[model samples]
Target: MIEIESVTKSYGDVRVLDDVSLTIPTGGITSLVGANGAGKSTLLSVAARLVPADGGRVRVDGMDVATAPGPVLARRLGVLRQENAMSVRLTVRELVAFGRFPHSGGRLTAEDHRLVDEAMAWFELGPLADRHLDQLSGGQRQRAYVAMVMCQGTDHVLLDEPLNNLDMRHAVQMMRMLRGMADELGRTVVLVVHDVNVASCYSDRIVAMREGRLVAEGPTAELMTPELLRKVFDVEVEVHELAGRRIGVPWS
Candidate 1:
């Protein structure tokens, strides 16, 4: 479980996360949703230790994230930030292989190679394995990055904007893959996403933030109401049931 205790952060005089406390249980997918500046991404970053919090603490699976050793924490938690950029050019296979560095220390063993191959095949990247990152489309690159994170073989995966540049089909595929990861592999998946409908459909729980404060959190079905969405996004939303799921439509 990920325990966030009254975490706070600030940028100059503006607060990005305001004493936000949340518990993300293990073995399922939880999505953070809100407007652009609602602190969803900031909260995720803090929990992943990509950014330090101004106050409070975060614990992952009973280990203090702030005090845990780098390699030890890396072994348990894997994170993928929104902007993935590399200064050096690398093939898709090389990028995926980098995920094993914590376990392999830059010298990949046979088991590492096997995991890399499995990750590439799982994401349907076998055809593009030899291609450089610059050579792939945005959606394909996003998938490759996610595959690298998954290849880390961690129990917890935290992703920021995982669906940023995908078309509808690939977006659906990505969510399905994440769902499979949680259901079959028993990994805890937490992501910052913009689309409420996507969160509604794929997430086991929904966390809503507004103005740097956590305003709502509950099971997917309970949090998908139009009132909660409007509270989070400050827009009129019409929520309807579609194919056994709740989908929200926003209006100006």
Candidate 2:
């Protein structure tokens, strides 16, 4: 579980996150939705301790994220930031194996090798395992990064725009794969998504942020109403029930 209390961040005079207090419980997928500058990504950064908060505190399952030992936190939480730019050339297998560094300390054991293989297979990267990152398409590269995060074997995973640069089919497949991770592995998954319909369909809970503060949060069913969508995205969207899911369509 991640406990965020009065979290705040600012760039110069512009505040990115303000007094944002949130509790992400264990073992489910939670999606954060809002406008581009709504502080969704900033909040995730603070919660993951990747960005320093000027005030308040964040704790993950009783461990203080800001003050805890680096290794201790790395073993418990895995984060995938939106900007993934690698300078060094590495094969997909090598990139995936990087996740095991926390456990293996740069020397992989047999168990580490097994987990890496499993992660590659799970993300369907077996065919491209030998290919370098530069050789893969954007979607394939994104999958490799995701596979790396999963190979970290952390209980909590925080991702910023996990669906970026994917086609419709791959996007749907990615969401389903995340759902499976939460249900089968009992891992906590928190991601920032722009598509409200996708969040409504795959997420157990939806967290809405706007103007540097969290405005709404609840189960997807309760959070998917037209009223809430308007409040968060500032767009008029019609909510419909289809195939046992609530999807929002923009006003035409």
Candidate 3:
């Protein structure tokens, strides 16, 4: 479990995350939904120790995120940021191998190589494994990046906008893959998502944030409502139950 105690972050005079506190459960998919500048990325970066919180602390499974050793924390947690700008000219396989550095320390054993290959295969990157990132399409590159993160073999995975730039088919495929990761591999997946309907249909829990604070957090059916949608996104939406799933249709 990831425990956050009064985590706060700021940029000069502007506070991005206000005295926020929340516990992310051990397994299953949890989606973070919020509008632009709602502190979603900031919170994920703080949790992953990519950014320092101005106040409070974050703990992953018992180790303090701020003080934990880099390799130790990397072995237990993997984070995919919103932007991945790689300057080096590296093949997809080489990029995914970087995730094993914590365990392999730049020396990949047979087992490490096997894991990397498995991740590449899991994300359907077998054909693109030798291709460089710049050579692939946006969706293909996204899948390669996701494979890299999965190659970390961490119990906790944090993805900021995993579905960015993906078409409907790819988006649905990614969601299904995440579900399999949680249900089959028992990994805890948390993602910052823009589409509330996707959040409603896939996530086990939905965390709604606004103005740097968490406004609501609960099961999809309970937390997803017309009033909640209006309050969170400031848009009137219709909620429907189709095929035992709660979906939202924003009123345009």
Using lDDT as the measure, which candidate wins?
1
Which lDDT tens digits does candidate 2 get at residues 1-252? 999999989999999988999999898999999999999998988888999899999999999899999888999999999989989999999999999988889999999999999999988999999999999999999999999999999999999999999999989888888998899999999999989888999999999999999999989999999899899988898999999999899865
Model 1: lDDT of residue 225 = 90
| Candidate 1 lDDT tens digits, 1-252 | 999999999999999999999999998999999999999999999998989999999999888898899899999999999998889999999999999988988999999999999999989999999999999999999999999999999999999999989999999999999999999999999999989999999999999999999999989999999888889998899998999999998863
Question: What lDDT tens digits, residue by residue, belong to model 3 across residues 126-152?
Answer: 988899899998998898889889999
lDDT of 3: 0.93
**Colliding pairs, model 1:** none
lDDT of 1 at 193: 90
RMSD of 3: 0.8
Better of 1 and 2 by lDDT: 1
lDDT minimum window of 10 residues, candidate 1? 243-252
